[model samples]
Target: MSNVTTINPATGDQLETYAQLSQGEAFAKVDACHDAFSQWKLRSLEDRASVINGLGKALRDNKEELAQLMTAEVGKLLKDSRDEVELCAAICDYTAANGPEELADEKRDPNNAGRGIVTYSPIGVIYGIQPWNFPAYQVIRYAIANLMTGNGVLLKHAANCTGSGLKIAEIFQQGGLPDGLFTVLVIDHDTSDEIIAHDKVRGVTLTGSDDAGRHIAEEAGKALKKTVLELGSNDAYMVLEDADIDKAVGICATARLYNNGQTCIAGKRFIVTEKVYDEFVEKYVSKFAAIKTGDPTAEDTDMGPMARDDLRKTLQQQVDKSVENGAKIACGGTIPDGPGAFYPATVLTDVAPGQPAYDDELFGPVASVIKAKDDEDAMRIANDSRYGLGGGIMSKNVDRAIELASKHFDTGMVFINTFGLADPSMPFGGVKNSGYGREHGGFGVKEFANAKAIFVGAE
Candidate 1:
């Protein structure tokens, strides 16, 4: 069997290696998960929720260890890693408290029947293909929802964060999850396809690139299995003519640099109106250039290395290609002399079509600044992309911004006058190239459920 080795991006140190499971072994695990689903789906929602609630407690109890593992494997800031664990715990808590109501049966009126009832029933096993950006949160986001919906969960986490995936499973078991109900598959891409083809695997979900999503969706479609894809995005954050320059600077900087700018929903494009374009770009560059990059474990560090060497290379290539296509570097464009995969917080100005910065997703600590003639042009530019995942609108006019976000901003989620991440109460997903289906806000629990309609008539 082959093995995958994980490295610490901040230190270039080999952390650990995990052996991949062969096709037969992976299939056996799938069978075991299916067998466990048979029993898990029979349990009452309250009973399943009780176990899920314990998962939050277990996560908090081992928060430090999980955080450190994440930092070592993915080069995420230590503080960010700790916060991710807390977020995972919160997801568990939210799913446990709100799942029953979301999945409860509903009564409906029928023309010919005395009464009609609709019930949300569990399907079967669900396989998740998650990324490494937020290891704990990514898995917990979908796993807890499906588990609370009375379905079994299987994970195929990014190879770099394999340890985090296994640790999460261990924590679930300690939280009283039944054995084999939540499994982690350590296999190659070929084996993963086979697992998707397995008849026992009822559903598949992925949070990765759009290309990977299409491939997985095609395979699942051939097998007639359902799939939920949360893919990549080049989210735009627009600064309108009436925007508060100072506030926009701070919010936009955080939106781009958070998680070292590896977030799919993090602001990649900055569309600023001509009224405040120069002022916004000046301060934005200062903010990015002033950022301190160092060891992820250091308390003073604001940004860490990218998750891997290849990711850094890909980001640099995009930046260089953008510059060659008429985009100009406003600040911090060059790669520093370092042993780690460290790319400075970069800003490109005069960004327009035909440039990677304008046309594609720059999945790193790079920001593209484009100037629009006016507020209308700013909104037009924001919506002029194949991606519609998440974005932000900066404006002093809260009412106008709200109206635009509610009506004109063609994205799944939008932040008005601020920068933020996913919330347990809000539905998350995107449109177009960003993929489909929704998660959170009680939407995920129904994604794999069987909504059965029943009717009764008086004899």
Candidate 2:
């Protein structure tokens, strides 16, 4: 039998190996999940909420141990890993509290002919293909919402974080979830394709690259299944002439470097008005250079290693190509010789079109600086990208920022004067290549639900 190995990116150590399930075994698991969903969907909404609440408590109860496991598996800072667990628990809490109302039947008027009600009925099974950056949160963001909506969940997490994925399934079971309701599939890419094509799997959701999204979307579409993709982006943050340079530098620096600089919605490009370009670049470069990279378990360490050496190499190639294409490396451009997959925090200037730094998502600890003529030019430059997941604006004028976010920003979600990860109360998703469908704020629970309409005849 084939096997998948989990490695610690921080220490270059092998953690564990999981045997891949054969085709028949994989199908059996899918059948089991479908069977569980058959019974799970019959339960009352309140009963589902009770189990989801228990899951939230379970996450908190196991936060420390799970956080440490994630850090060991994915190389995220210990604190960040703990925070990720907290965010996952918060998602459970939010879904449990709001899911019933969000998925409740809505009374509707069918052209005044009769009374109509739209019921959000649970689908059978949802297969989630998640990445390793936010291990717990990625699974929780989709899995919890689906569970609350009375659907079975199947996870095919990144190979490097297999332990974290299995641990999550264990937590769900400990929280009173029924057997087979949440299953972790430690399988190969071919097996994943088979699982996606299985008749029992109802819907698919993926959080990964645009290419991966395209592949999964194609396969799922061939099966006549619905999909929700949260792909990649080279999100831009504009610093207007009226912006507070100091505050903008601080927030933008944090946004760029958060998650060891591997976030999809991270502030990769900084479009600054000419008035503040020089000052912003100076401070931003200094901030990037001052970042402390070391062991992720260290409490004072600000940055950690990339999740894998291959990922680091890809990031290095992107940086090299960008420099060859006329972008200047202002802060960090060299890969430090180390045992871990550690890349220094980097800042690039003179970033223009025709360069990877200007055109694509870096997906690492690299920031691209673009100079714009004015506020109008800044907004224009921000929209000049194919990927539009998330972006931000920093200006003292709150009204102007709101206006840009409301009408001008071409992305799905926008941040104003601050940087944030995700909020349970806010809808999170992207447009264009960044993928479609919303995740939080009550949109996720209904994504895979069947909206059945029941009409009453006049007696």
Clashes of each: 0, 0
In angstroms, what RMSD does candidate 1 have relative to the true structure?
0.7
On the 0 to 100 scale, the lDDT of residue 441 in model 2 is: 94
User: For this target, which candidate reaches the highest lDDT against the unseen true structure?
Assistant: 1
* Native-to-model Cα distance after best TM-score fit, residue 272 in candidate 2, in Å: 0.6
**Which sections of candidate 1 miss by over 4 Å?**
none
**What TM-scores do the predictions have?**
0.99, 0.99
lDDT of each: 0.94, 0.94
Q: lDDT tens string, model 2, 1-459?
A: 688898898989999989988988888999999999999999988899999999999999999999999999889999999999999999989898999999888999897557899999998999999999998999999999899888999999999999999999999889999999999988889989999999999999999999999999999999999999999999999999999999999999999999999998899999999999999999999999999998999999999999999999999999999999999999988999969999999999999999999899999999999999999999999999999899999999999899999999999889999985899999999999999988999999989899998988765
10 residues in a row with least lDDT, candidate 2:
107-116
lDDT of 2: 0.94
Error of 2 at 386 (Å): 0.7
